[model samples]
Target: MGLLLKEVEVLVVGGGNAGFSAAISAAESGAKRVMLIDACPEHWAGGNSYFTAGAFRTVYHGLDGLLPIVNNVDKAMVKKIDMKAYTADDFTQDIHRICSGRSDPELSQILVHESNAAVKWLAKHGVRFQLPFNRQAYEVDGRFKFWGGLSLKTQDGGKGLIEDLRRAANTLGIHVVFSTAAKRLGVDARIGSVRSVFVQTADGIEQEIRATAVILAAGGFEANSRMRAQYLGPNWDLAKVRGTPYNTGTCLEMAIRDASAKQAGNWSGCHSVAWDAHAPPHEGDRLISNEFTKSGYPLGLMVNTEGDRFVDEGVDLRNYTYAIFGKAILAQPGHTAFQVWDSQMIPWLRDEEYREGRVERIIASSLSGLAQKCAKHGLTNPGKFVETIAEYNEAAVAFQRENPSKKWDPGVRDGLSTQSKTKRLSLAKSNWAVPLIKGPFMAVKVTCGVTFTFGGLAVDPKTAGVISSTSNSVIPGLYCAGEMLGGLFYGNYPGGSGLTSGSVFGRRAGKAAAAASKTWNEDIQLLSRL
Candidate 1:
């Protein structure tokens, strides 16, 4: 005979940020028995959240200059972003515009309304955060005034948050198991309700976990190349760069295999920022931080295979990233777009800590030395590359001179969608207005990369219950949140929204699941009596 199964009021799959918040919310929502499971040995370590700069854009009372600029959205929902700018209406409109009207309006409303509550809940659990005193240049309207996002300080920051949630869960008598992997989800055949979860323990023993409600918070499949190729087809190469090494999409696979789950949203091969992982300076090359979206000296200048500048140099890094990615797609398979900079930019890169440890002095010595460095990196012909730098410097000097008022604004306004007019003009010109006439330029190849695939299973707004698009019915007790749920974000991703979405939806899923568990229990009792 088969062994008897364990039982719980709620079962949460995956222990990343979404899973962590969901587990805690479920326990707090009055689930008598809750069990959270993760495949990681201890807890998830170094997931994408830890790598994030931890910026959150909100409309609150005190903050003024850190939120995104939302020009209009009378019909859209908006909320507190900061004190000075971005009212609730503005926030909702900005998000809705990004969504392009396809997102579930109910979920969007919940996200806007519950985001602050989620922040409060996180703070109550001991997550530390600071208000935005200064907004990044890209956040033109300052929505992030009153409340800012939290940054984790721990060996494994992602795991640290999970640990914090675990403690909160423990205090509420919730059960958490590490080194346990769910093998398959149990679903009732008649109504397609999730019946239980089957998992393999560390000792290689199979066990069944019965739950009245189940939440599948399993993350995106960025790490699974096979799935990426299958789902994305020609764009499979975009998934080569792994967002989280452990996110192999096993649960996503299981969901797709079952008849209950359906796909949502279209795949947008969003552009990604690049860092030379192998030859970075001492700190380890990541994205250039200090020089990002600020001044001109360390600004990014993208060039095509023929060493010609493309796109506006002064565009926001995130938006500029997409343009550069387009250039990469046009380049020969092995030849991608490259960023060329001078030795003078190294100090800014080093100070920001984003450049890792490489310094400007070390990057360039004399004209000849820079050329040799380029040759070593296989960027271009040493002599040709050096000459290109000198030419660019001359042009830069000339360009600056032609514009008498160098401090003049670029005149960007809302609804200006033309790409040609957005091209960056020179900030400083030479005596007679020439281009770059200096030497010792450095070049690094860049390719189009992706962080995570945003497409996945569809879910309802409030309950986060998994739904079948064909049948237009909810799989009674199944739920999903975080990167696992698609259609929440489409076409573009606004800053600070990813983490907020996960927290907001995860909590809703947990609370709704806990309530469903009780309803299921009562239904069973009534049936028994009948």
Candidate 2:
């Protein structure tokens, strides 16, 4: 027998935003004690939430709507900002549009309804809020205009959000253990109810932690290449992870085996994006993990290693199309692609992920010169690459003469979607299609990076209980949240919905699990008497 730990009323696995939210909500709901565990070491405890930009999607009626959920900002700052209303319909439509209409309607309803509540809850706890200055706004006549429903961000980036969650958890007296991995999830022999968790402690001791209920808030299996190869097929093993390496899907696997967890959603699908090809395999370094990810695909054109365009670069706004573009890159030879842009579109480029004139880049003065630079950087058929850009530019010019065009604007609509400015090409650049003229161009290489698996165990919408497909019944005393619980998203997801889904479901899961724990205890007592 290994070490036996004291029992707790609720046990939450994972220490990221979802985990912290569940633990805090459970404690507030009167769980006698709540124990939260993280597989990573102390400093790296936030999981994927730490590695993100920390944008949240909430429905708001312009600036006045934000006033209820937003705080900690100066009145002068608020007065200067102009925002557009992002109603529930807009949020719902956007979700289904990107998800290809496969997102669970029940879960989507919860996400949209409680979106504001989730933001306000975290803000009430410990998180600070400010209008996202850099990512969500553009300067208009010297004043900042905020667009997108994703205007409010944590005081800092992803790091600050998780830090605030951790601070709140500590203040509420929730017990958190880092560097602890769950080895087993114990279920009742006869009742088929989860009761305890067995964990490998940081010090190498196997500890049995008895709890009234367990919430699998850990995350998806994005970091496990073997699992990726198994679910997403052969070439996916080559995909880079955009977040934590510790999210190896241990808790999800253990629950599936020990309990009859019904898997749902797209097993082969995930939320992937074009990340820096030079970034490390598992995102080990924090300094460069998120910073090096270039999101300026709209400002230029993407060419595969074969020096050919795979998809229409301007088919949609970067916000709407970026998540799905990584797979196109993955499909390319060598699982790589390059983005090329010229001086004409320089001002519209993002300032976040790159240092101007730095990082790995091939700069040139002419189309052929750029092709030569591409050849040096391991691209094949450099001439074809230059030809593609020239063709694209010619089409852009022709389209502009025939159709009305709008200058690319960002702030008024939080970087709203762009429309085709030129005649539709075979792969038409729909929006923000600027001709790549005036040389002094550059290219940065990239590839597919998986963020989270879009598939996991299905949960009951009302109670957050794992729903058994075998019997269509609840797995008693077992609950789930975060990436481990599925049926919310399918092939693709809108920007900023992942974090919001986690928080909304995490809150519900914790409250439901705590209440169910009491029911389980009473059932046991009644059975003993019988």
Q: What is the lDDT of residue 133 in candidate 1?
A: 28
Cα lDDT, all candidates: 0.56, 0.80
Error of 1 at 33 (Å): 1.2
* Residue-by-residue lDDT tens digits, candidate 2, 320-406: 777788888899999999998888765656676656633577778987898888787778988888888888888777766665444
Candidate 2 lDDT for residue 308: 80
Give candidate 1 misplaced runs (Cα > 4 Å): 1-5, 43-47, 64-84, 96-106, 131-163, 233-242, 268-271, 279-298, 304-306, 310-313, 317-337, 343-347, 350-362, 365-371, 381-399, 406-449
Can you give the TM-score per candidate against the true fold? Answer: 0.75, 0.93
lDDT tens digits, residue span 108-134, model 1: 677777766676677576554443223
Ten-residue stretch with the least lDDT total in model 1: 410-419
| Model 2 alpha-carbon drift over 4 Å, by segment | 1-5, 68-73, 356-358, 410-424, 520-530
